[model samples]
Target: MQDIPELENCRLCEWQCGVNRLEGELGVCRIGRPKVASAVLHPAPPQSYTIFLSGCNFRCLGCQNWSIAHFPDTNETPRGYVEPECLGEEAYDVVNSREGKFLGADRIFFSGGSPTPSLPYVEQVVREARKIGDIKVNYDTNGFLTVDSLKRVIEFTDSITFDIKAYHDDVHRALTGAPVEPVLRNARYLAENAREKLWEFRILLIPKISVGEIKPLVDYISGIDPTLPLNFLAFRPNFVLENYKGASKELMEKAVRMAKEGGLENVDWSGRVGLPGRLSEKTSDKYENKGGEIAGGIAKEAGCVTHPRNCVACELEHECPIKNYRPAKKSI
Candidate 1:
């Protein structure tokens, strides 16, 4: 373990916890060694096996995978320890298997707990896997890794699925227990240097908690490259934020509209489209103008089908004017 290329004083993420993980010391990310929570063949995005690593650099209050991300590093056996050679061999077999090829599961995704903690191990897996098949690797990250680590990651992975939690420093720290500047730095660096390999950016709108984070976040990413695939995910209340309601369809639609207004060319959203308020994203479905016919009366008067009461909080409220309307008029 001491011989592994672990940072003497860890500087993997912006936290710079500097705890020397090679000696089996824990930092805020809380993993002394590279540990994986689970590995499953995800039959989506052209099929891939997703390795969910344990421990996260940022302790997000609303994290859905807290059990895994915030788990104790006491027993690595539960959190499987697959060395590069064996893990890579398994991955190669999985991808090249008849079932894998038929199902289009030709890639591997290294996800987290923010993959930053397990980056060295992940890279090793990528190297070993390539020996068997030229398997593409998708690195799913929270965008908090240091610029140097990100460059090394880009060397092995084919694409990145990055997450942007918020734009400002204070809000980000309050929400994720980390500052936002490091995320922004890595984002811009990736855009400037590895733009083509940036597969997509994922943003979660945490209803009342993080509604304020969407616009500025969108503006910054749009500035970098509007063509970059930006996906807005609806937040499901979980972990510390379990009491709060999930995001709404109306909220997501407003978000989509704002993203378009911010000059983002490739924009989309995922989650269920249910009633006007307090909707849940647990229902997996693409966004649709399902509320188009339901728009009328209050909805028409507010120039929105949802007629959401959080007007001041909504960045798009100014785009619509209040006016008396005839019946059956629906504004999407």
Candidate 2:
């Protein structure tokens, strides 16, 4: 696949500002030139394991990593870039270190503000990681990539955790500053083609903003496959909308019910288990809460108890949230 020419005039993301990202041109996503932020061997909860990339495609009003996503003008800009080979090397090291040192990780995840915006860079990273071993590679994405872009990277990915913001185009646009059409299209395409691969749909049930839109979003997902796992995240205000309140438990339950009523067979809550204050502590509380819920909820729904028995012997125990939770005796 050829590098998107738009990468040079990068409107790949929601910002759609035709900025030259390859020539060190910074667009709304803030990543200039090459692959920016990268971390290997991180323990992402509920989702198991993965690598994280920086930069984003959307200018979410309540973005958590505003520093990275919005590219704060005050901080020193990152100048270094990690090549795909270097990324692969780092991933290999992480896998080896985890296995040799008894770190309990079984998967690799590619996450970002919107990873599809940097398909070429991510493809390079995934291709290299695949060379090391047969690790399950997953993409945690916003479901905004064009079909052509999705086709290019879909083969390299083993699973996808796709975020569906809202069912209606207007609501989706209002919430994320991007249209819902592309997201919906990609979701349907992935469901049909990537069904054998674990394809989970996530929705953030924002208090006032997203509640009414739940039925439509759930209806759309149900039409694809009622058995597809639909995750509902409780919204917390942070980043740009610090004053916005977190979704009430009652509201979250209502959204979950909406999904079930829409004929969705597999549904789970990716919202806060019980902590209200934890949302305020994070930079992008809403985004963090959404991500945490997706990771945690999906893991629990998969039959791995909140506190997996294997977690006790893991070296990264201190950092593992999955082990910290009291086991839910009932299945989600």
Candidate 3:
């Protein structure tokens, strides 16, 4: 594997820890070299060969793909260090295969724990893949990237599926273990500047957990441009929130209505609904926001030692129990 010299002073995401990833110094993401957890020919919209990258910058409590997201901390053995050119060529072949065409596949999707941590590697892969053929590329992101990093993403990706976990700072922090400002900022940047490349702004509605975020989030997005595509994802119980109730069909419908009412012209909802589970009794009175309190409580129960869940600033950044948490339940 070739070294990214920039990894010597890595500042790929908002954390900007400046750690030498090549020399094994860890940052909030804790990934040194980018590794592929897996790759599959997915049948979802914008269907393509989905490349799951290992490791993430956020310690999201209800992470559906926790094993891949937590990576080294979670005992996940990734397909360690495929040469960028090799993986890129593989992605090209996979997306252009007969199986890919039968599934309506049209692009190579780069998803992860969150792709921000592996931006350089992804960029390199795109370069190599495009060299093989005119392969379209889609980037699925958590929207926690820095301004410069987001710019690079927009430059390379044919389309982007951006995730906005929550709108309010407190709720966002508690849910994702990171601040919401950067994510919102990046979302705004995309909507205002690169709307054509944005596939959609995906908001996962986790019943009581993220219900409150819809109105404010819709307002924020519509305020920028009501025509910007927005999708409400029905959250399933997973990771630390494994026992938490999944979003109901009624709630998903209501979310779409709420977004449309809030002036979002292109609003819709999707995902499996109503898988059985109970809401968490654990909750913190520390946060002013109800959603934050609930999510913060779950994070606490899962051994996250920080209130407000600032993983980048927390003393346990390297030794984070949330990153190493082994959930008893796996929703999938």
Candidate 4:
């Protein structure tokens, strides 16, 4: 952990707990040392060697990579910490391999439950990789990072895939146990200030859950820059929302249409569509906000005790039921 000094009094993200992760004081992320959940030569757009980092700041209800995100809280084990130098060399070698070229690989992609928790470690890895040879790097984020963190991310990353869960604060909190303000702030900062490094903005369409958010979110992004790339991903239920209905193909098409009509010039959609499940009963009264009542209801059913779902402020954050939850169903 000495290689990444930020762990001493980490403020890498908005929580700013100031805990010494190096000496075992845990913050909201609960990650002591950076660890690699897994690494793969992915075939997705901007194909490259994708490194899945362990742990996350957000306890999202619909996380597809819960096994990696929830980490030690869950039964799944990760490929623990590797020296940044070694991992960097491996990333460079693999991305330049013949198999990589055949698959159109051209960069090293940092993805996780959210990469902000491991920002310092990621910088070390990139530094070591560049010593071997210049390598393009892409960062996939939920956009909950602080202004300083966002600036650091923009400094090293060649591209960024940003996720916007909801436009409304209540809905964002209900869905991810965090406020939407910081995410929105970071999104606007990237679009207005560092547009060149941005790859695209990704919004997951979760049947009825995210539909109401689409129009408002679209308007917000188009307001920043109508030409910024945006992609609506069809949701396949996982994590606490494992039993919820997945987004249908028709829903995704509708989202694209809505974005286009809302004035986004570069709108698109992706991901597997129409996996089976039933929408849970809405418990709007559980939350004060009406925007994400259904999502709030689902979180309530899954044992999230906090109203409005502020993880950073919740007294039960360390022993979060949502973090410990093991869903019986996984649509993906």
Candidate 5:
């Protein structure tokens, strides 16, 4: 934050791996350099020119972008390496595109395996982008940054989409391969010091590991300030959890209720469905799966088919959870 010049002992993320990234030493991310995976105009919420960087500190079983996030030991030539200035310029052009300038795209989102590992590069991009024209930066983070790095992030970025995977430390470790302290610290820091820059705190509602975590997380945030915004991302079956069905509308409703009862305000999730029946029963009816879970057809009828993490430009994006969640008439 003040002047983290060399990567001799990288303490960028919460891992504190202490590996010398400058000397070809790799940390848990398995990447020693700033290698990006892809960049595109994403229309998730307010559309953003999202940049995805390679490597992550967490090894989540439900990683949606595992293909890029977890890089295998391959002999092929590596790609997706771009200078920070070029990326910043490209983002500036996309946000100010002539054909449709006002379609709610106003920010350049730094996403990844997690942005913590690319603090220097991302900050440079933010600076370069702002130099060209008025630009806004949003960090889609896992909230594992150190206090100093977070201070620098607050100095530059306009808003942050902070992630809180689990509330309990043991459950958090079991789910994400990381402790819950750093995320909790950063979230509390933002709520207390930089509330204006805090866009929202997000939690992925995993079926067994994290569904029950919603209440504790809500209570923690309520302890800080119930007015802080929280978004519950219904878990999409991905990677190791592929066979499992996504979090049901009923479960998330209970989550919402708990949060509201805990005195939280502004609670919303990604796509809404169901008519009082639980995800395990009734809804599937004639077309139940062999395991009695929600089948593809039933999910399609309800609006989501266990959404993929990044569903940009897909034909059926209208029904995807990452893009939209149509609430029931009563809830609306």
Candidate 6:
């Protein structure tokens, strides 16, 4: 592991809050140095195997991981503070568990409030994870990263899930307190360089606010490359924005149609409205009782399910994680 300064202060993202992360220096994201809420080799609600990181750059008022992303102090006490080497060891152990052994996931996802903000540490983790296993690292980001930093980590990542909060600059700024230019630039760069690496562009469709915004964004993405997979996310009110209503079924459909109309192909409407996955179900009785267990079981089963249709027809499949399913047992 590269031994650099102890991140006495970090300015990795747009926030540029040069506070010493190691010394528990609180920044806008409300995090003190390498604070990780939880790290486990679990099947994500989206049905994909993932490793989650904590901390962020922007302060979206409606952040789902408010505890981890917005207020890092509210949760469990911070544990052994170490460098990226420690994270790598932890990740290896998680991914190699009995369940991880079954999935044999080549992909290691870097997810968080805004992973870009912690590029230094994240890159360290990715470098270490790669050495331990033949893994294709992926970044789940808000696309607010600096181009320089983005380029640095791009080498370590095989693919990226870039979030375009809104197409319209004003709306984007309003929703994320940031402009859309950086996101657009990063998306274009990634598409140009990693076109064949499964660059899934996602946009959260919020009620009323995202209707007009969808068309322009879709049009922009279509211009980028019609084959680029566009995922229209169904916004849910989970954390700080509990009072805000979720995107209605109608609105989500309209957004999907708009993407198609904008000339984008390979669009996946399975996020919520079209196909119901463990993460997408809002109030189904089946989901209420079995969603958590099913999600857990699927992850544990690893390499046991195949075919996207199974996920599509399962009544709980929203964004199947295994790409084109390989093979595995049914959820226990």
Name the candidate that leads on lDDT: 3
Highest TM-score, which number? 3
Clashes of each: 1, 4, 0, 0, 1, 13
Lowest summed lDDT window (length 10), candidate 3: 323-332
- What lDDT score is found at residue 261 in candidate 3? 92
Candidate 1, 50-107: lDDT as tens digits: 8888877765655766666665632323446778888888888887788778778868
Off by over 4 Å in 4: 1-3, 286-291
lDDT of 4 by residue, 1-332 (tens): 34567889999888888999888888888888888999999999889999999999999989989888987688878888988899999999999999998999999999987778999889999999999999999999999899999999999999999999998888898999888999999999999999999999999888777878999999999999999999999899798888888889999999999999999999999988888888888665755545489889888887888888889888888888888998896547
**For candidate 5, which ten residues in a row score worst on lDDT?**
323-332
What residue runs in model 6 are displaced by over 4 Å at the alpha carbon?
1-9, 18-27, 45-49, 73-83, 101-104, 271-332
RMSD of 6: 13.8
Q: Model 3 lDDT vs. the true structure?
A: 0.90
Residues 99-214 of candidate 3 have per-residue lDDT tens digits of 98899999999998987888899999999999988989999999988899999999998999999999999999999888999999999999899999999999999978898899
Report the Cα lDDT for candidate 4.
0.89
Candidate 5 lDDT score at position 40: 78
Candidate 1 stretches greater than 4 Å from native:
1-3, 44-46, 73-77, 273-332
Where is model 3 more than 4 Å wrong at Cα? Answer: none
Q: Candidate 2: which stretches are off by over 4 Å?
A: 1-6, 9-19, 25-30, 45-49, 72-79, 99-103, 273-332
lDDT at residue 101 of model 3 (Cα atoms): 86
TM-score of each: 0.79, 0.73, 0.98, 0.97, 0.78, 0.73
Assess candidate 5 and give its lDDT: 0.69
Clash count for candidate 4 is 0
What digit string (tens of lDDT, one per residue) describes model 2 on residues 1-332? 23446578775543456778767665545566544554545554434345545656554544554444443232425424677777766676676674623656555677755666667777777778778776667788887776777776578877788888777654554345455678888888888887866567878776556666777788888898999888787776554444456678887787778878889889878656332422322222122233333322333333333222122233432333221223222112
TM-score of 5: 0.78
lDDT of each: 0.68, 0.59, 0.90, 0.89, 0.69, 0.59
Candidate 4 TM-score over all chains jointly: 0.97
